[model samples]
Target chain A: MLKLPSVPGGAPPRPGTPAAEPASLKDNASEAAISALGWLDERTAISGTARWVMFRKVPKGTNWFYTLGTSTMMAFLSQVVTGVFLAMYYDPSPNNAYESMRHINNDVFLGQFVHGMHRWGATTMVVLIFLHMGRTFFFGAYKYPRELNWVIGVILVLLTMIMALTGYLLPWDQRSYWATAVGVNVFASAPIAGPYLGDFLRAGPEFGATTLSRFYAIHMLLLPGLIGGLIAAHLYLVIKHGTTAPPWIEAEIDEDLRKSEA
Target chain B: MPDTSKNTSPYTADRNIPGAFEGETVTRRRFMTGAAHATNGIAVGMIALPAIGFALGPNFKKLEERWEAVGRPDEFSPTEYISRTITVVAGAGETGKTTVYLRERNPDIDHEPEDEYNQYIAISTRCMHLGCPVRYVPASQRFICPCHGGVYDFLGEVQGGPPVRPLDRFYTRVKDGLVELGPRFSVNSELKRFSPRDPAQDLDALGQYLFPSRPTIRKIPGT
Candidate 1:
């Protein structure tokens, strides 16, 4: 039997403390399950890692604002789910792109709803991320050891914008066409290397099959892959450094440190 | 004795603190380490520059508009409006087919007309609300957007339902007997002229306040 330390201030156990009872069937089953987990944990160290990351103590005074990051993460996951569903029916060719969108919008079961969710979810993610960033800035959580995480976050913001821009062109509507045209033209205005760079992006000299293909590839594969890797890095950093305390809490800590030294 | 050494409490004084891993010592090794990090950063940035430039190249090129011939003026009937699809090759090498709504007006009823060339008015089929293709309903004499309930009159004026302004029109000209269509220009709300105005701009000040304008092509960059 394992022994536990006595409580600091507690009444002494009665003189006739009851002897330990034998394990019942239910208790045996639970013990067996715990031992199985222990066997796995011995090899994988899963329990220790989970305790270290998941159960780490965060500073007090965190409010609902902290939830924005999780909300953004959920929104991004929804985008990935809906985006995959969309890719199953969406044809990347300019010729069939609009027609496929029409078919999805009007024909497929719950297609319009899913598309709407993805669209609204993208906007929600953008807004939530911005709010999250604002909260971080206001709390000065991006200072000191968290600076690299902030830089990663800025990269994420840029990637999200690029994802939105690339996704906008998939509909092949007049708005998308003209908007993409103008968007690409803006890149062409870059000084000496502008024309060459613009041509490469368009996949030639203009927005055609190549442009659609490139944008589709970037939207569906490249940007998502990059964002996923960056998100992993961001989360790792967050866990590694731990969350920054609110300004008041930090100030209190500072005061305590100065007082103790004095 | 209690196994205090096994306890990994976060409240312990020697717990890891962020940015405090490096000892408080200024040495040649630290300077060299910082310089190495800076060099690695510059190397990574140099590699990233060409990749980003290549990926974003399309945004740098200017696209010129091209005109496409739809049909001869005589081919379209004066009695009823007809919609024709014309494939226009625009900027770089992008080709798209746009629906052009053509109707010949009676010269007798024209006290002041917008199209003086051949009494032919070519309106775009794209809805002003969200760019869904609006279908022409002859019985109701209105262009009805199926996506939403947006309705436009025969003159392309917004009669009801979510449309902010009239449908966009194509710059049409009659050369010889063929009707040549230019790039699309949205209609002005107050003047009813073909201009590069966004329908969002036509919203009342209060409406604008209620409905914020999204990033659109109408807002020119840098100004």
Candidate 2:
């Protein structure tokens, strides 16, 4: 029941949209506004903080490829803002599911594009997540303590696929139908949990109205809820362990020796 | 709020990284120094291969589900069975595909509402046998897999061959003149339910006709 915030004319912005707009824009409006928080007032204050705690220095030759992760995060943030716009129009019902999509596609403001973005965003998220993992692997970032984060990340990756799977079925279209069929077949590999999992997903052995409700709950409520938790743990670990160092760090073993000799 | 005396850096950083503290102060100019400049062209070297990979393959759409449209109940003829190819639309450039059946309602045909006039059954074209597209032989009133001669009845119930189960069906219903299909799912058992909890009749192929639970692969000695 999270409502989008009311736009001046459109539906209210979805609650919790982290839009950094006019507030920063209006702050640039006048000299008085600029003076109100006098730049120099805190300029010197910024220098007083724990330097290491407040900032970080790069290794002498780290690569810019690291920017992809940063950009990917920016993309995810963009998805969050747009996703809020989507949830407002989506109807969590077996009956109205298709129409709800149609509404989002044709009726809501930028509905078609927002839905397109969410759909594409999902595809992008999965791809980016893999790219991120591959980058880590090639960099040997998964060799030590970082492996735990990678494992957690593996869980996140699977969770992301699951999120897409469950959300895919929510549309209640043929694509969802057959694709879920094939998807459930993957679980059949679990032996004991396979059949039951399949049954659980299809709602008594065949996808039907009840199955739609089931997928909807998982897609909207269960997944985001779980992802939020996992991501929290991940972010905490990331802050604790820090970004993976470049190959040069390991390569520097000889350089540090040379520098010391010099 | 004017002091630069108390800040401390976290990293024992090399002097090149931007946003890193040397002692207690960080200058944007320093932030964008050697660390940023030194490796300006390296991102392409690192991430290009994966970027190219993303464009050329299916590596397969790990995403479960695509899209299928429901046909209107009116579009179907009551007596004539329609084996309409239901096209599924999926983004990311996949050619989505599926099939749904629409047949006439014979109220007096002694079946449940699910099997009544205009039963909408959206099924996959793949045969439960070794995965071949099934063809509905209208004359024989059965689904025949051309690959290995596996045969199925109208409901995709395996009549004879190597198929383990019936052809899968996407959930089907009629609304707003469109026969809406839900996310595709396997229709293994030939169980039928038209109305929820309040079914008009108990219907099953075992009850209605000679539908085999599975088609056999072993040859009969003398048939």
Best-performing candidate as measured by lDDT: 1
Model 1 deviation from the true structure expressed as Cα RMSD, one decimal place:
14.5
lDDT, residue A244, model 1: 78
lDDT (tens digit, per residue) of candidate 2 on A149-257: 7888788788888888887876666567656755665553243344445545644433445567777777776677777677767666666676667876654468888
Candidate 2 CAPRI assessment class: incorrect
True A-B contacts kept by model 2: 0.00
Candidate 1, residue A219: Cα displacement in angstroms equals: 0.9
Chain A: TM-score in each candidate?
A: 0.82, 0.72
Worst 10 residues of 1 chain B by lDDT: B214-223
Residue runs of model 1 more than 4 Å from their true location after superposition = A1-32, A253-262, B1-223
**For residues A1-262, what per-residue lDDT tens digits would candidate 1 score against the true structure?**
3323323453354355354766667756755566567667767889877887788778888778888887888889999999999999999887788889999999999999998998899899899889989999999999998999999999999999888888888888878886776566455444445445456666654357768989999999999999999999999898899887777764445888789999
Per-residue error for A14 in candidate 2, Å, reads 44
Candidate whose TM-score is highest: 1
Off by over 4 Å in 2: A1-54, A248-262, B1-135, B138-223
Cα RMSDs of all predictions?
Answer: 14.5, 21.7
